[model samples]
Target: MGAEQNWIPTEIGPADVGAEATPYGLIDHLQRLEDLTGLLTREKALVFRGFGVTPGELDKVFDLLLPNRLAYVHGNSPRTKVGQNLYTSTEYPQEFTISMHNEMSYAHQWPARLAFYCEVAAETGGATPVVDGVRWLAALDPEVREAFAGGVRYLQNLHDGYGFGKSWQQTFETDSREEVEAFLAGTEATWEWKKDGGLRVAQLRPATTRHPVTGTEVWFNQADQWHPAGLGDETAATLASIMPVEDLPQSVTLADGSPIPAEWVEQIRDRGLDEAVNVDWRPGDVLLIDNVLVGHGRRPFTGSRRVLVAMSD
Candidate 1:
């Protein structure tokens, strides 16, 4: 492999891998991945392509990759579930790019791995760009890096049932307030239920973390995604002119409540995209990534694109 291709995923086609283009072929590929011990951890990602894997056979392949298949708890984005623990990626309007970040990095615990399956490839420009966490961290300016030393504060403003942004019911995937309170209690986060049927939460989370296995610290938070500053000048200014930052549906600030400069967050967001290796999808392609070692995002696309994701501990 060429040095330029180092960040691209390790791809295996059915023919080259000597496996038939079917569900069983995916099993063969999974077995091969297992045989090549440390490949997932070393390469950080693997893409199985040209397998002709269908939606009906996806569960079998997913079970092999994510045995436990953890629930998407405390996720901030909107998505529709079409399968067990599998969902359409980030349901953000397709035109906007989803920025890079480690999945659930703000939570008390995060997934160790994430597996993605492409059931329908986009007609144009739909690619899941991935970046090495180490590379991303190195790309940030030292000032921005030091600014986050005390970590970050994440705030979520959930509506009761009718209002802008997600309702507490939809955000937590539950109708029971008791359950939501219990979940937040466990996270050691502050929360309150408003008389108007809204839910407000605030949590302090680290900006960086050491991988459990590799022990290498990496950039690991969604500050860029949560801050209005990173939402593009027009969008950020629009949101700012409408409401105060803390009143936004989702917002982030320094752990001490200091405002994070727009440019600082922009730098972190821009460089990650600049350094990423984009993985264009083909129907039936699956990508497996070590969640802590890599960060992923989406490119603006046109037409239909259905990508299902699952996670493992």
Candidate 2:
């Protein structure tokens, strides 16, 4: 498996780095940062292995990787903040697999880089499967690609402070309606307030984007995560039974106000996973990537696993 995903990073042990995996070692590497920066931009991902970094030294290591960290505002996934800016990876049950997505690709702005640090490794599975955006785009059926050519429409139904799905406060990281409204004004989106104290948001975003420096076209979007069809029939049916489609926590369709066929969504979900390169993790390992150039997902795992993630623009 490792040989097949040769694009994935290989372990860079302490001996290979010629220093212990400590704050000082990180600082020393930064002195010759230009070469590393060029390599990261070209490769899109890297992993620092066997660097026995502790929780207290995470800040120092992260500062080297992400100079100006950004808050996960407007994110839809379930996560818990365990430190100042660091957060636990998606909080889904261990039995389920998390599909691939570029960080905040659905938003008008997104993180340019991200770092994932493993504090504990799972006894089984729990690999971070990644894919080259170029490869993923190639693996898709031509018909599915053409269907999403125009773009996608994303709809989010956020509660005032109760009920299913994340509250508006958690999604926008604010309790004040004024702040939420202010933030939405800056994006290419519109919204309406529901009588039931829910906020219904609608936005049209591109299904693909080009990398800034490399100018590489990548299949970039979160339609799979937003669309009910991507979930199994049983789960999608349950959500539809409970509420109107528009009232669901999240939904998506084509940009021209037409339905996206379930088959299209299923192919997008399946092809991405089929072509992904899974990177099995070890404790104390840190995976860094150029967010737009790569898509990442979580595989099902057993036993305890703690992967802390943070991002920067």
For each candidate, give its TM-score against the true structure.
0.95, 0.94
Q: Report, for every candidate in turn, its global Cα lDDT versus the true structure.
A: 0.87, 0.85
What tens-digit string does per-residue lDDT give for candidate 2 at 160-251? Answer: 88889998889998888899999999998899888987788898999989999989888899898888878879999998899987778988
Worst 10 residues of 1 by lDDT: 1-10
For model 2, the run of ten residues with the poorest summed lDDT: 1-10
Residues 183-279, model 1: lDDT tens digits = 8888979998888989999999999988876687878998999999888999999998999988899999999999999899899999999989999
Report how far off residue 9 is in candidate 1 (Å): 1.9
Over 4 Å off, model 2 = 1-6, 21-23
Q: List the residue pairs that clash in candidate 1.
A: none
Model 1 C-alpha RMSD vs. true structure (Å) is 2.2
RMSD of each: 2.2, 2.4
Residue pairs in steric clash, candidate 2?
none
